[model samples]
Target: MLIIFIICILALNPIAATENSSDWKTQKVENVNFKLAPQYENGELVNSKYYTIKNMFIFSIRYIDSDSFLKSSYGDDASSEDTHYIKNKNIKGHNSSIIYQERNIDGVKYNTTYIYFPIKDEIYCISYNGSNITQDIEEMIKNTPKQTMSEKKFYSKLTHATVSYEYSQREENSYNDYYYRTPYQYNNQNKNQWGKYYLAYSLGRSSRYYY
Candidate 1:
């Protein structure tokens, strides 16, 4: 009887934990509506919303005007060779552009996935940095309600300033020979700088120093 009771408790614990971990809640930014697991850390920056899960995976949504939409709809021009397109197809009734990026940071390989689509005058970019969460992130993008943004423009200089500050800090921490290195070296020097440029260029201003 004791053994049977222990086995029953073990089986029930997993079911309970699974239920709790899968508790997804709906969230809205502007007119777009998407779902996120209850256990998440989220923040906002200018025209962007960022969410972090399990302290490893990061997801973000940025709203940009038509011009920036067209430019980023196909990924960046100065992207590193480590980045490439995965697919461009319809996912859950929405035409989405997806890309895969890999970088070697301090001997550890990091992977990121990005999805972009346009809704009305604004383009929505959904990106995740980490592993084993592609399916969940895609579902979040697919489940998002496609709604038109208002006519009021949503550009922010603060986003550019913040990115610039972050870039400077990254440079300070990078190796001394960073500037003298090859393009690939520079790209690896600051993998996060790519996303910073995304935010900068989205604001219609190009960064003087780019990787």
Candidate 2:
């Protein structure tokens, strides 16, 4: 089964300072048939669950030949036909977003927020997800140091990465359980993620698609 091996980013709050929260702006755009969500603008917590503290941004783009776009924009081979981006049905619903690691592109930097659909060979569809690539960029948005978008560099670094595949093998048992592993390639070098985090891995079969 195709499962989304999500590296749950126990992400930290934005750390930079900004004064751009003049007011909250919420706009929804539909690209082709899918939707586009470009920024994180607000937050509200309900029933012990954070309704929308807006830690993520989302956008969807549909292409007749989705593979072509992924290859050109992200690399030589990409697909999004199988990619799924679930909506809350209601604006207040919570769902998952597919985001790859960040990277630099064409002298500009942006963290990628996209999901891919790799068909027989190339990608079939994709969605522009979110990016919080650097500490400075994150700080600027979260208004960590402060909380606004005014004086900061007006841009965030976005990375479009090659799709990745991961696999695991385990002994089958009557009862199902899970374990944890440290994240790969993330530099929390200067940050202290101490008692604030945990990881879980299932010892049985569980599949999920990220969109």
Candidate 3:
């Protein structure tokens, strides 16, 4: 009986697929191809630059030194904005542009801004694999935002999406967010199919850094 019930659930998994209205989109930033733009690679003060790949502006600036901004991909804790958005709560996650609700920075309330960067007036960030060796990218991963599959879309299976603002702590900043589309499966027999994946994903939080 239990096996039959489980089978029925899996068969109806697609029906229970929780789709976010803002989940995946077919649109994408154009004209720019983000190339890490590592400071160590360029030797400090990477200098902001605009690329035609995504038409977004990108910069690779160094730490303020006096202030503790731009620590690591996720190791930053000095920004008042962080605490302002979360407000006495622990940061659940972060990325190029996937900010949270509220956090405090410098005793002032602020939004926990995501890593998404800014261009001439846009935002950009990069995301790679999510199920390979790990879930989320920490300061240990390539100095880039390693978003889970949930945060990304493939160019093939997307309809439409728009971008807002792009931001970064670097000088040679260029692109920020990418709106692509990927394959999406609907299986009723997999209600909690991705639950484990997501749980592990949420747990694979990014690391924080301080300069």
Candidate 4:
């Protein structure tokens, strides 16, 4: 029953994006096998790689420890508008607050969600980009297997599509669902600059894992 309003994100064209032969590669972290898609460079594992969904959004996922992540992201900065804490009612059995951060990089706005929790004796963090903390995202964190790595992808197919107020009355549920049903691309006529240029490279990629 967790729901949040997800605003329209700027879209991009997907090029040089690779698809996995299978799904995710299995790696054991903290005594749990984690399914991951570590970018392979010349057959060797790389730390991070960019994922581009045609006409949607581009994002990257990396593996790092909780302490390093916190220190690197925020160094001795007090709480403010850019950084805030939110309580999630959907995540059960965990006593941690979800930290939300908003950043503007090169005039492009980015939203990040951070969750810190322990797997057995070791603490770990999972983060991702989205306009808001939707219920689906919280459930993804809540159900991650202890000691095992879990992978999730949210994406879409339409390159020219934009979800706007004019088309908001569609009956489909979930943001992903909305994209799945709405295939008409947005025409910039009479639209504002933001609306005309909105793009999300991470649409229609939900519950998918790759190797």
- Which candidate comes out best when scored by lDDT? 1
> Which residues of candidate 2, in runs, are more than 4 Å off?
1-32, 35-60, 64-99, 118-124, 129-211
Cα deviation of 149, candidate 1, in Å:
12
lDDT of 2 by residue, 1-211 (tens): 1232232322232321223333334322221211112243433322221223322223323332433343354432223322223221111111112435444446654444543322122222333335323332222223212212221111110123333211111222212332232343133421333212221123232222110
How does model 2 fare in lDDT?
0.28
Off by over 4 Å in 1: 1-23, 39-57, 69-74, 105-109, 130-133, 147-211
lDDT of each: 0.54, 0.28, 0.29, 0.38
Question: What is the per-residue lDDT of model 1 for residues 5-66, given as tens digits with 9 covering 90 to 100?
Answer: 99999887744433443456666655666676443335443332433342222556655444
| TM-score of structure candidate 3 | 0.20
Which residue segments of model 3 deviate by more than 4 Å? Answer: 6-8, 11-25, 31-78, 81-211
The C-alpha TM-scores of every prediction are 0.46, 0.22, 0.20, 0.37
TM-score-better candidate, 1 vs 2: 1
Tens-digit per-residue lDDT, 70-108, candidate 3? 233322322324323321111123222332325444685
Q: Residue 49: error of model 2 in Å?
A: 36
